[model samples]
Target chain A: MTERVRVKTMMPPGHVRTPAYLRGKVGVIERELGGFSNPEQLAYGLPAEERPLYRVRFTMEEVWGAAAETPTDTVDAEIFGHWLERL
Target chain B: MPHDHPSHSHEGMSPSGHPYRADNDTALTYWQRMEIAVRELLVEKGAVTPEEVARQIDTMDARSPANGAAVVARAWVDPDFKARLLQDASAASREMGFDIGPLRLIAVENTESVHNLIVCTLCSCYPRNLLGLPPDWYKTRAYRSRAVIEPRAVLREFGVELPDHVQVRVHDSTADMRYVVLPARPAGTEGLDEAELAALVTRDSMIGTGLPRTP
Candidate 1:
């Protein structure tokens, strides 16, 4: 089964890679890119830990609802493992 | 001989025919001053030499959309290369002798039914190693916010009106990876050679904003 995940909805103010529009949205993992240094920690000049990154694909309807120009169309974003909650 | 006033050459255009910006003549901005200070500090600290900085700038200037166009043209002509590109874009580009450094690239194909668009919502994370610098419009807040929400409208603004059946997949370059769209080969160009095919590839075509020129 394809792994489903939801983007975390936390709105803390800081350097974050996850976009605000994707917060609270659900999507399936499109692919798993290898581990990369976490930018959130790097932004503060802190020692950053490596985090797994995954490209998550969400339907336009899921992201924008009725406002979506084409509901079946999709949006893909690279999200860090920390920001994703497996569903 | 010393001139009293500045000499006019090429009617204010560079040898490449592009208008030269009066960057040096203008008063240094805050950011420019900061850059100079930091560069001087780095040189003083022996972190890097001025020659090294100049060489790095030359390397960056040498990279342009033409490099990407060559890659796309090769992919269009060779199915094996195209498969490899779709599987591992960075490796494939390196095979073609492009110095992409450590850029993680993903080549998304534009087919009869699917089209791909790239945007960096957090910042302008682009395939700069392959395609040179990102355009000014790409960094605008308007393009960043609207790309994911209303991609079709944005495509229309770029003179691309897709049919209803075509799927628009917008890739938000939010994290480590960068994306480039592999535009479909135009019809009636089967007779063209690799260089000719490459000529048809435009910067916007690779960015998914426009289609390749028809031969």
Candidate 2:
């Protein structure tokens, strides 16, 4: 049960799972969805290195800033371990 | 020299809304035609059988929102079933004779305090086995772009207004896992039977776009 982490803003080319909006954003670990093959590597027909994936929860305010209508609104995204760093 | 091919004909709109002008003007783009050619070559090589392909298509076509409605109606009446559904959605759905196939299914409950919404930003990935094909808007760039960023406004557009105290949780089905929202049974419908309850469960409710019919 990992607590809090930040999505790393890795601007890699080609297929990537991490959405652009979540990059460099801080979020809480809602659930650990176990491990999955790194999609970034798999997209290139390379052997994938399985990494831990977590369902991270981010507040609407954190994501949308002042544009957020509801401050309590939350968003959850499944992010791989390689893209996350401990907050 | 130009020749008219008997097999090819100018046709109506394709499934993706592409116009088939004429045989010379292919219905599909060059890349799409190339993709089909490659697929046919693979099939010719016995990588995958045509029968298997047809069967898969049949499975997809057979699915509808009614399957999801049945599960939600049962959960509304049976607390034990609801517990099982929340605990292990895939196994519980299988128990009800619904084939979830290989994807992981997660049922999120919408209580008084929390609301659950689902989206697939990368693509229009959904629980097609239970909910049929996703609506066209779900695949549009507007939805995929704004869902995670402004869920409250999006829900409002769907006429789903929640109190400020209640938290809205937008679940992005980014990976292999799919999600379904187990909406709270509407009030004043306690006397209705299971079949009636099932009738109230709309396709949008399961997708968190709207709520079950109000009694």
Candidate 3:
């Protein structure tokens, strides 16, 4: 079972699927969306390493901080497992 | 402004006694030309069949937001179907005869407390199998960045106003998976039948960029 986690604030230099604004953000695992070939490696035509993908749910507050118009709102993103760290 | 002339033809003689030519109406963009060239080359090289390419194009052309509207309308009336749809979108779409291709499709429901919004931050990844092509704005960099940054404000710009207590959930499709929002049925739509309800569902509503028109 995948667990809720926070995205690591790492700025790796390459083709990445995770958005910049979502780094270091806390979100709960809505569901595991199965594994797929890592897109980062695929972009470079390298051997693709399969990685688990999850639909992560974040409170609007977690992403936008004070700028969030609706503090109670939530957002979900499909992210690979490697970007997430256990909260 | 008056282009309704009875004798509007380009086959006229110019002052220099030369035939006047009309502008090229069927102009292809650089990218479009490149795409056609690549597709044709692939077919010629036996990498892909021309018929297969034509079928794929036809399938894409056959799809529209109306397919999504029909699904949402069915879900509003049938509880069992709604549960199945929320559980497995691709299968549910297929049940209603929608060809979802090979991509994984997920349907997020909007309830009394939670409202669902769909966006593709990386690219314009969407359930095109049902909702047809992504709109021009959906592919904009501003939308991609702002939708995730300030979803509520963005929703407001689209004229979707949720109550303070309602929690808006924005789904950012980033991978092979595609998402479609199953928008909440408007309150006054209780007396409407399935077809009428479907008519009420707009393309923007399915994208969570707008609400169903109030009856």
Candidate 4:
């Protein structure tokens, strides 16, 4: 089964890899892109922990709703593990 | 006594036909001053030599859309290479002798029914190792915000009007990965070799903002 996930809507003020537009949006894992250092920690010059990253695919309807240019079109983004919650 | 230093002129375009960068004679911006200070500090601390910095700049300057064009052209002619390119773009680029240096690349294919567009909504992260620097428009607020939201309209602005039957996929470089679109080869070019095909591949086509030239 394809892994389904929801992006956390946390709006913490810092250097975050997750974009504001994707927060709270639900999407499916397109592919696992292996592990990468957490940018949030790296931005503060701290020792960053490695996190698994996945490419998440969201339909235009899910991302833009009624304002979608093409309701069935898709958007893909690389989101770290911590930001994604299994759904 | 009045001293006349050699007057540096900026009247015409350079030999490359592009206007010379005005930063040399212009007042140093705050960021430029900061860069100078940081470079001097780094040199003083024995972190890096001026020659190393110059060499790195030259390396970056040598990378351009032509590198990406060659990759696309080879993919168009060789099915095995195309498969490998789609599987792992970074390795495929290196196989073709382009030094991409730590850039994790993803090659998105454009088929008859699917089109791919790339954007960096958060910032201007691009496949710079393959396509040189992102165009000024790619970094603009309009392109970044609208590319994902209204990609069809954005494509139209770039002179690409896709039919409703074709699905559009927008790749936002929000993290570590970078994407390059492998545009479909135009029809009626069977006689053309790899070099001719490469000549027809434009930077925008690889970025998915525009289509490859029809010839």
Best by TM-score: 4
lDDT of 4 by residue, B1-215 (tens): 12322364445767544566676577889999999999999999999999999999899889999999999999999999999999999999999999999999999999999999999999999999888988999999999999998999999999999999999999999999999999999999899999999999999999999998988
lDDT of 1 by residue, B137-166 (tens): 999999998898899999999999999999
lDDT tens digits, residues B86-174, model 2? 98788888889998787688899999998999899988889887788888998888887777777778889999988888888998888
TM-score of each: 0.90, 0.87, 0.84, 0.90
Looking at model 1 chain A, report the run of 10 residues with the lowest lDDT sum: A11-20
Better of 1 and 2 by lDDT: 1
lDDT of 3 at B173: 90
Off by over 4 Å in 2: B1-26
Distance (Å) between predicted and true CA of B1, model 3? Answer: 14
Better of 2 and 3 by DockQ: 3
Cα deviation of B55, candidate 4, in Å: 1.5
Q: Local distance difference test, per candidate?
A: 0.94, 0.87, 0.86, 0.94
The better candidate by lDDT, 1 or 3, is 1
**Candidate order (DockQ):** 4, 1, 3, 2
Query: Which CAPRI category fits model 4?
Result: high
Q: Tell how far residue A78 is off in model 1, in angstroms.
A: 0.5
On a 0 to 100 scale, what is the lDDT of residue A85 in model 3? Answer: 94
Rate residue B20 of model 4 by lDDT.
67
Model 3: runs farther than 4 Å from truth?
A44-46, B1-37
Error of 1 at B203 (Å): 0.5
